[model samples]
Target: MFPLVMIASLVALGLLVVYYVGGYLFQNRSLSDIPAASPWAALTRFWLVREARFGRRYLTVDDAHKTHGDFVRIQPNHVSIANVNAINAIYGHGNGFLKSDFYDAFVAVSRGLFSTRSRADHTRKRKIVAHTFSAKSVMQFEQYMHQNLNELLRQWDLICQKAPANSKFARFDCLPWFAYLTFDTIGDLAFGSPFGMLKNGQDTIEYMDYPGGPSKYMHAVDALSRRGEAFAVLGCLPFLKKIGHLLPDSFLRNGVRSGSQVAGIAIARVGERLASTATKGTERVDILTRLMEGKDVKGQPLGREELTAEALTQLIAGSDTTSNTLTGIFYWLLKSPGVLAKLQAEVDTVILSPTDEVAFQTVKNLPYLKACMNEGMRIHSTSALGLPRVVPIDGPAIEICGRTFEPGTVLSVPNYTIHRLESIWGADSDQYRPERWESLTDDQKKAFVPFGHGPRSCVGRNVAEMEVTLAMATLVRRYDFELYQERFETWEGFLRKGFCCEVGIRRRMT
Candidate 1:
């Protein structure tokens, strides 16, 4: 009798879930006209969750655009727009498209600029740190950049030194090397100290249980990647977070742990900086120093919690995005030897010698080098996935690219899809040809949004440009690479990241 009752209860629960989900999908009357990516997309959120969990969310959505055209219903309420013209209506300033609830998963100590939804709040936050990312301010960070790059070159030099007696090349993975470079550079710039990742050749870093508490080490890059993928999956269906501990999926489970670890790491860094500031009675010229002194709209200095949150944002944003771009550029360069030669020629003109520090002013305006970087960004988009924005339910009707989107509809322009559109980029849109960027059409310019479109675009754009160009120039001027793998594979989670770019690198003959 007990077993029969249990079976009946289970059946009832299943029926209730089905009924609820069915109603939830069909209840959104405004979304009826938008074409669903698939029947599964229309029926359940499972398909979306699966794609996000397994790290193909961006690709899957891009494929949907190929089949369904510009507007695709990736989720019951979410529409993915692939049209370039829709950019202004959707993401332009004062468009009333607040960041969707999808960003709630990315919240660390508090809502940093990237995760903040409120327009006024985003404005206030941007005001606090925007100057630090400006062109001039970012140039000030080049000293730290050069230091970290030198450390990276030291490690790579040792690897090359170990090459066989006859061979000029030594096998090394460029992706992790780039990761180390970016992480250390950002660490020094943000915290007034480096993570020592480049020197150590490992991702392990120390964190604390709390401020001034016992410290322990964790693999930060792995934690960050796992948390990013996991949070992306869970963010789609936020309810899963509550029962995350009970879930069978280890990735999701580990992501929850990683999130805590990341938070703790941020807290620990902020705490150390505060302690240092108090005891030393002097401040280093770093992002944290500016944050420590920054006043909010109310004229109050940001609290420790806010400072830690911003620090966490900087670590995640400042490192991975630029590193991924660097990796992408290297992958493309190695694949196209002719292009690489051309870029090297341009770089050599400016960089002069292997030991010469690549300055921002020297490399910033090089046309071919700029073209190569632009091409790399276009081909291998870091933030491949669409950043979802909500059409405010209370706002006036907004028309985007000849179609009126109902209020409360979630919308996004998938960067991966728009970038690869044959209409804008011509027939060879899929290729990694730097020459294409040398003569881009007006449509191509509109379609290119690796940083993103409108006011909410990446605030750290200047810093990213300085980091990438300087690093790439230094690399091309110093080494010649032979790729180990035939294909450069990438996966899309929080950002599109390469698995690895294994190469046989040797000192440049020049």
Candidate 2:
């Protein structure tokens, strides 16, 4: 029995050695064959560790491109390419590259628009809700947005009026305000019910007595989604997946539960909208309404489950992204008095007056104001990190800055890094200079991509721009703002979400 056990152990040891040797050989061949850029050192084994530890892991991959040229190998299997031409080849229409499993962290129920891996699945899902955000649908919902903005302006005016005679005015956190506005706006559009955020001046949505408000729960979910990426890297080792769950029950489970609760709210809201369609008068025609009532290319109405998932995805994407952008822009405006004055001047000249109400279309046309907004977004990009995409099976070898990446490799181009590229935007790229935008030729403007570029760019771009334009125009018109606190530090976690800004606003006595 002892002899037999020894022989079995020897065989297992031999198998382990063969596996390690084969892995090393494969990695060596892959790294050696690639025509990588001069800067990329050929060290395959510790690439992931170096990227996670030494490198600016939190800075968007765009920084990597600026430092390492257009294509930089991040890990053995991962490369980040920031070339404009590659955007078309990779994410353009009919591009066969699938979203990498890195996005699996973003998925909730193994199905949903953002979570689904297949192109066909995405097409079908996108089709069902396409009309909801259509030009007409957005126009129809203008009243809802206008009402919310009006309320927000009213609150600001009251805050301005109530400022102490001697003491500085109440410093406001734009993050929460934008969060309130965005959640209320999306809530009204998606569920036909505003969370009354503007009414309450906060996110007061109730679900299981979760602390830190609904937005906090949302933030938790956003943070938890990145855990799967960590798991994937660690799980490459034996028994890691099984052991990972045993490490500790952190915010992940709470986040998943919160996400599920949010999804449940979306599902319930859809049902309520459908039930009240008869009496609701014209159905409001929000994205949720169109999604529930619209048909696919096959002329088939979306299934009930599909409708719920799509609606939930729209609410999350639409609300969170716009909120983050607004918060970032507002923080920047508060930080720079010069930029704020310029933006205020532009607003006053174009859209702001004692009797004139700021309209989205009019505000959007103000070039300086637009430049300020664009520059703010460029510097403090919400979607700082690049969306990961896997190379297609039979696609051409991706060549960037003289280096060719192999097919089936994962690549990303973080907007955070791209926006800061000195070569593209010149030396003031790191500085918040709206004038730089004014001086740029049309060709230069093409590189400013806060909403991303190409066919798969943000579907809600128009709505987001309009919302932000109106909000900023309104705030600038009524109040002269200053940063109450000097330095604002960012908490870098899952997304490049902004915080730590406390601004004091006073009513313009003109």
Candidate 3:
């Protein structure tokens, strides 16, 4: 009886192993059963190792799209679609896809607005803050924006003046300046207190410190995010969570502590704002106030935890993305002198005086400047990496270029690859030509998705654009700048961090 029982147990264990392995292999099945080209074969084990060790060659992904046409499986269970039609199908409203576990890394504080994976949950969270980003709410914050821009311009003027007469040609990267302006603006708007980045010329956020500067934190977060992806992959194992606890406490502690600090700050700020109804007039009308006053579809007020998560999410989303986009714009403009001149001409023509506070209406009329901003966003999208989404159960099987993706298949459309595709944008697609935007028809414009498409598109996109336009206009109109470093290299360690362009600046003679 004992021998028979041992043999049965061994047989059961063997079957279990076979079952799991078969499922694993089947889950990662090739997408080539349909008519799509097998372009991913080129990116074999050797190539992946090289690509992983070195940084992501976004240019290489662009090249792959050219060779493979619209749809190509770039990795095992991962595919890239360059077709414009696919964008709507992949990320459009009611697309029936939820963000994949790849986004789980961003869940720093218990599933905030950005970290929520469920379509229903996202809709609920979005509704709570939808009014805050409406046209009316943004206009209300115009004064706050103007004040921040003025602060930035004042600082730049001082910096330009301080350069020694002999060394007046001193060069410094405009990236840091843009970073300070973006973070400071978001800091004030979100937390009601500036990180004092613009005033101090450094990131003095109590918990987080951008050692090499604000840009360095971008790099660190990118690296850490990649590590988090590895953890998620490992999490598939049954006992991995238990093993995770055995890993270094510091790794888990830092993330938890940082999240707690951010949440604490946001909670405290909201409490303070709510406490002082005396000063809660138009001046206190930031995103926080809007959120505090908001109620869900069922007329339930957002709870304290929900408010904290949402607020911190806004702070992160508003600050980093805007900073990255603005940095990219400055980087490109400084390199292309003619583009800079054209932008300056538009600003000068529209604003009449560069130093004067730019009203929303005046800034809106500068089509060329707007086009330039759009082009920069397209060329070097801050959200360059593919935002992964999982296929929903009971949804129509997604067919991309004759290839069928089953439910639960992880899918994405890499923006970096899509934006630079020759088939979509013509030969000079990779070049920074804002004029290309002018040539685009309405249909083509609809395909141009820097902030993504549909309801899930960036909530703060309008605010971000306004901030970038005002900052670029103010800087170009006030200064004549040259690239300190000629070559532009992007370090895509994780979230396209260390992506900067160094430049030299001198105040233009009035």
TM-score of each predicted structure versus truth? 0.95, 0.82, 0.82
TM-score of 2: 0.82
Which digits, one per residue and each the tens of the lDDT, describe model 2 over residues 282-309?
5366777777687878889977677777
Looking at model 2, residue 207 earns an lDDT score of: 35
For model 1 the local lDDT of residue 27 reads 64
RMSD of each: 2.1, 5.5, 6.1
- For candidate 1, write residues 74-135 as lDDT tens digits: 88778899998987778887777899988887887788888888888888888887867766
Q: Indicate which candidate wins on TM-score.
A: 1
Task: Give the residue spans of candidate 2 off by over 4 A.
Answer: 1-28, 32-56, 60-67, 207-253, 278-282, 352-355, 441-443
Highest-scoring model, lDDT: 1
Ranking, TM-score, top scorer first: 1, 3, 2
How much lDDT does each candidate structure score? 0.85, 0.64, 0.66
